[model samples]
Target chain A: MKEIATYVERTFESVPDSQRKSEIMQEIIERLEDSAGKLEQDGKAREDAINKAIVDFGNLDEILQELRGQETGKGKALSSLWFAVIGSLLVIALTVFINLYYSPGVVWFLYPTFAVIWWPLCIFFFGKWRKGR
Target chain B: MVSSDLLRGHLETILLRLIGETDRYGYELFSEIDGRAGGRLVVKEATLYAVLQRLERQGYITSYQGDVSGGSKRRYYHMTPLGKANLEQGIREWHEAQEIINIFLRGNIQ
Candidate 1:
């Protein structure tokens, strides 16, 4: 059990995201347990069967490579979106800070409102429009 | 014993043939391979997973979660129609290659 658990943990360490990593590790553990269980039923000792199962299951490096590919493929697109969002938000905050500091509030709310609100709505509708196309 | 290195080249064909019969969960998939090969071809889990990922990417297979009796959810993979077509093509090519190899092996060709 410890052997398989350690193996799973180590293999998944290269994989990103706790949720996906955990699910994969769990799937692997279930498979390992089942294989080892059948082996035990076939007359092998519990520990030996488990050890053999781990050996037979082989490594996760290739899986990790594929997972990393998936990570980057999606991450690249989302990361750019995040960069734009963060950059705009910082500029909006700076403008708001200047407005609050210099003029002591007249229409500073407009800066944050347009920055946070209308921008996302436009992106959403624009994305939907592109999809429709 | 057949080396896994030899088996690696045929993994896609092997999977297509197996999954063509029925949808298979990850565990049983490997077990069946081991069973069919008479324990001579023990596939590395990572290698099989990589193949599965590639098949899914190429639209050759699709996977879904299986709600088994136990709470554990298993990922079940089924071949796509495209996968069947691909397998058919692979089989044809293999047969042609096999014929040529057989001729060479039989000393009919240099």
Candidate 2:
């Protein structure tokens, strides 16, 4: 099963480090091992069983692409939230500048600031709900 | 061999039905699929895992580590109520699709 372990490791080498990645790797290795064991029980030699198991496991690239896509999806969501936050901050900054520069006495920036704050808050809560789902 | 493209869409339902039958580990599930397909279908390992992960993420199934004979643990997957409901719905849809396709195939365009 050393070969199987090595194959799984090499296949997952490019996957971003995550707890889920490690768990998946372990699961794949165990599955391959189990398959090879079954083949050995069916009268195949250890080496032949291992080789056949690996061959039957099929391409890993497809799996890698999926895992990478999932990670990228998560990263995209987080980056979008950050973008919203930065955008809201910039908007608030502009409002503050306009208020301070034009009419600091009235102080009407708080209304826009309150409205802008909700953008990131909505995204943050949506993200949390999505993750929980 | 059956084209994977044809089987891809129904793979989720098939797996859910299998898991619904009983809790199965990865190897057992793969082997069962292969055996049931009778060598007519070739399910790639990557495809199976991808579907499994997707189903898990969708709350259709849950997994746990199970003790095996060799002092090793295997991850077994069990279907949830949501999965069972989905499976039933899939079966209904499949039957509807089959009937519609059969009508077309049979040249009963009316």
Candidate 3:
């Protein structure tokens, strides 16, 4: 059992630290111990049971790739939305500054501001659609 | 042995159905699948956990830690209402696919 726990911890060493990572590791170790115990109960030698249990757990790389893929996908979508939002804000700020400096009597920045708002709105909807996919 | 690729699409439904039957821990779920398949199909633990995580994230399932003998705890997964609804839809689609595939396999296509 200690061997199984150590094996799980070592395997997770390459994974970036996070609450999710620790939870996954804990769950995996418990499952491996359960499997090893059952194999031992089936009359296999303890060493053999532990080895078989580890083998049957399969490659951690595949799981890591999956986890990374999900994280990257989510990050990309969120970052893109943030980029749109920041870009829109910058554009609006520039427009407001020009309007205030050049045409202090006219208030026309609101028109361009409406158009700028659509940038983040579109990106937000796109992010939602991508996530649904 | 069943190809993992072929099983991948239905794996979620299979898991949902299993969990819908009763709450089970990770190891117990895998053992049930292995037993039901009679060793003809084996789902890698990595893949199983990934699918389980996806299901939980999608709000189709929830998990809680349950105490077992020997003072140990196990994370047990339970299907939610959304999962039951999804399972029903999955079964409907599966039946439809089966019926269509049978037309070709049985040479009944006109």
Best by DockQ: 1
Candidate 2 chain B lDDT trough over 10 residues, lowest sum: B65-74
| Clash pairs, model 1 backbone | none
TM-score of each: 0.64, 0.70, 0.71
Badly placed stretches (over 4 Å) of model 2 are: A34-52, A65-71, A78-82, A85-133, B107-110
The TM-score obtained by chain A of candidate 1 when compared with the true chain A:
0.49
Candidate 1 Cα misplacement greater than 4 A, ranges = A18-20, A36-50, A72-133, B107-110
Worst 10 residues of 2 chain A by lDDT: A62-71
Query: Of 1 and 2, which scores higher on DockQ?
Result: 1
Error of 1 at A86 (Å): 26
The C-alpha interface RMSD of every prediction is: 1.6, 1.9, 2.1
TM per candidate, chain B: 0.89, 0.92, 0.92
TM-score: which is higher, 1 or 2?
2
Instruction: Please write out the lDDT profile of model 3 over residues B2-108, one tens digit for every residue.
Output: 89898789999999999999998887888899999998887998789988888887889999988875666778899999999999999999999999988879765
lDDT of 1 by residue, B13-76 (tens): 8898899999997767877998988988878776787788778877898888887757777888
DockQ of each: 0.45, 0.39, 0.41
